[model samples]
Target: MSLEKLDLASPDLVNENIEKIAALFPNCVTESSKGKAIDFDLLKQELSDSVVEGNKERYRLEWPGKREAIVTANLPTTKTLRPVREDSVDFDNTENLYIEGDNLEVLKLLQESYLNKIKMIYIDPPYNTGKDFIYKDNFSKDEEKELLESGQTDEYKNRLITNPDTAGRYHSDWLSMMYSRLKLARNLLTQDGAVFVSIDENENHNLRKICDEIFGERNFVAELIWQKKTGSSDAKNIATITEYVIIYSKEITSLAFNQDEDAHDNARYKYKDEYYEERGPFYYDNLDRGTLGYHESLDYGIPTPNGGLAFPNGRTKKLNDGWRWKWGKKKLEWGLNNGFIEVQESSSKDCGWGVYYKIYLNVDNEGNPKKRSSPYKNIIQGILNTHASNEAKDLFNRTGIFSNPKPTNLIYNLLKIGSNENDILLDFFSGSASSAQAVLKANSEDNFRRKYIQVQIPEPTDDKSDAFKEGYNSICEIGKERIRRAAKKIKEETKADIDYGFRVYRLDESNMQDVYYKPQEYDQGQLDAFADNVKPDRTSDDLLAQVMIDWGLPLSLKIERIDIKGKEVFKVAENSLYACFDKGIDEEFAKEIANDSPLRIVFKDSGFKNDTAKTNVKQLLKQLSPETEMKVI
Candidate 1:
């Protein structure tokens, strides 16, 4: 009856993938240092038709750090997201999330809850333009303090070296950074989901190949050419006015992109019908369509004005040639009776008479209201950098705050195409949170409650930058403020009752003490000092947040705190989980919670009076709610 300790760490993506593979092909699974891992050689043999040999030439997007990137993606992070209630907006009820941290670690943390849950992903990562950016192509851990002392890395350990084209690993390092993120991002997509990545001329081709490798070549949706400016004098030879938004679907079979509803050709519906209000207009098409191989049943005649039946192609029933009625016998009868058929005297001597069936412009024969939509074009224009700057000016009443953050309109367009009602959208490289505002704006117009998660690294802003001067010390601050300002502006303008708030969480080290993860590394005296597995600085809220993540519960889920016998208890998403972190947790509290039949239960191990008390609490829950999964931290 001993309660198991909750790992309370980011999911081990490598182990999870191996377990998945093991479930499909059990023979490929083997023991490794990590325990329960895939034997790649065995897996290859299982998958291949012939013997798999040494490194063979194959088509793939490779880079110097590709192996490291893949390893980094598979590595488990001990980082956990702690709720920043002070920085949050409507922390208790809001569906949106604004996570602050390095996106790589943040992506790893999110893997547990958000896997296959996001409907759309939009990212505007650092464009690697050899300017102010992080993750420099050149650096070493051994020179870390020396590098920082010499102004190489920032306080947050973000390498701030200029990665010019002359650098040995310019493209390789950028690709390495992007490859791991994209690898993790691909798992967060729903089957019908797609990712839209914004890039310039420098890396669009490389990104295309990378996406093709990750999302599969067949899942490549489109390379949308967005006109960022009318023209740019900064360009040397050809004006670099355009950029690209490359899209790739999670699964090609499930991906069905939306179309432009307003762009349909309205003029084509020139003719009206009795069903105009329901089905709109009507146009006639020949009922007797000529066929290469006519069926005998389709060659039958329709009743004419002369009381004699008119055969197909003026045939006298005895003669035959390849011709058939577009509508079947039953449909022809129904169409004629329902005012859907039109009969007229023939212009040609061959047929002599003609029969036409009305083609409704909007709805089908069943009369369900249908939409005529124009295909979403690959070329996006009119959404420009000036609009984005104007938006910054309008929001902050200043220009050059974010150096041309994406216009909300651009992401709004993407949302319309890739997502709809109640769908979740994510942006890992969420600078200025344009994607967040887009979700809010779209929901207001469409009345669809589309939620979003915005993850941004708190990259420090330049001292001379307007954003830094305006009291926004970092890009995270700018992003948070933009959402706040944009929410107010959009709400006032539209007066829409949409979610205008987000829960803020900052990524940090796990809430557990080091001895909890590695007891072997600590001495008996050190272990004695760490009787409480949880970190001293961490709060009950922090513990709850980590437990929620480790339990694979989304951060957006509703949490209700209630006091049971002078002890605080958190009930997440109505019986999804129940946790009590207060001291002196006894059978009395356990029985009360067990009555509600929670799917999962957690308690701080130190909360119990002793080991016997912990056993008693576990036994109490078992008798009351046998299905409840008990865990401790």
Candidate 2:
């Protein structure tokens, strides 16, 4: 989630491809004294405060910590959540995604591939109701820190059921879990994006404060209230029906919410009965009292079109206060001619003698739809058992995957109000895949291309439940089934040919080269560099792809490979990026490549045969192509 600033022209950047770098960081680049380049350090500092320019100024930075700390030993956790084989569940190319793993680890892994790409985040984490399990999330143990320092991905550890009802420390566990996850989720949000968290009364207040701390209090949006259930016929101590959704943005004012349309439902605008007279069925009050250009002398003796003297109460005098009719006399007369205005006869003392205007039912001009304000009411009638049951039935064929599922209508309305069709939606606590289903359904119905990423832990199912009896073995299984069925139903209904498929990315041990962790000195004489016995599981090409994802590079970015002398070199089309991860590269190879003028060129630290040769290569490349960037992978 850290934002790093980059300088395409810096010596650290081996690639001198200015055009390609500009394309990668479209808005972050500026015309500096040298040329088009990025301010990497400034970008990193802004992330600590806020991102700017519609999320375009944001970039991923290295994790913060002491750079020279000693490495520690590593150990494996005794308790781990295992994943079941999902061979049976079918996943089409749907935009919705679901993963089973600890969300913190998943977020770290995703940082290499989906950083700063997500636009919206929504989660319904456990309310810490004394029974809830707060993930222990201690990733850097002393031993693990050593392993990471020596180059390795750390295995995480977690704990459950630590919230004690009377410990007065009950809020501590929930706050810790939420704080870490919110920090990670904030990284995932686009600069012009936000997050919404659903919670009951128990921890809503506590969660709001933590969110404010992470996203900044200035970015806090509205706290939406949703009625979770209908009122019961038999009540005890008052039924708890509503829940709250606390919202915040990565950058204030970047995200947009739909303004409500005003309601012009007034009974005075309705006609009583028609056909009684040419004026039609009309109700009238004093028009002259609030009319424009009124004089006290002209108040009582004014003439009506019907040849009747205007009543005393129908005063044409202007009041000291700013009271006046909205329309002028010509407009009032036009309304009378159009049978919309009328004069009341024999009006009682309290009813007054002023003329009233009849605003017709389907004929009045309502103001802009965007001018409406959101209504705050305690009861939301849309929440009912039938609604929940029907949504569950549609996703799981009435088997009822989970009992405490939120109504789709609730999430649906929130998405409509707080997000756009093209926004990226996320659900870190995706139980029963309700949020995923809601996103697919919403997109298909609205002809929008909204995307979603859902994360779930493959927690085992209860043996006594129907899901267990029906061969549904785990929560993740139920989630996969729900997504499968939802996609099929949406395709059948919409008949729209779209990529409903998701790129299946599973979390595993890093696909990095093992040689990256070997000791500096190896074997008898130590003539050759030490390399891992396991060989490299991830190639340099793979690392390049991972970096692309980390830097918020598009998946479809064009890349090409060229052969210089006897070595294979990669060229990124848009950035004019040249990467040489190959080892034992000589000066002739570097010079020949530099002759073609690459804007940026990256070589492996182990690529050049010697330090003198490496220095010569950089010097030659710089002299030949002055604007080219050079770096070592």
> lDDT per residue, candidate 1, 229-342, as tens digits?
887778779888888899999999998777564322233456887545566677666677553356777778888877667777765463456676766789888877777887
Candidate 2 global Cα RMSD: 20.0
lDDT of 1: 0.83
After superposing candidate 2, which stretches have Cα over 4 Å from the reference?
Answer: 1-97, 109-117, 139-168, 231-236, 260-381, 468-474, 513-545, 554-633
Top-TM-score candidate index: 1
Best by lDDT: 1
Over the stretch 100-158, how does candidate 2's per-residue lDDT look in tens digits? 67665555445424667787788888887787656644445565555445433323322
Model 1: residues >4 Å from true position, as ranges? Answer: 20-47, 51-53, 136-153, 157-161, 262-276, 279-373, 377-379
In model 1, how large is the Cα lDDT of residue 218?
98
| Count: clashes, candidate 1 | 0
Please give the lDDT score for candidate 2: 0.58
Instruction: State the TM-score for model 2.
Output: 0.55
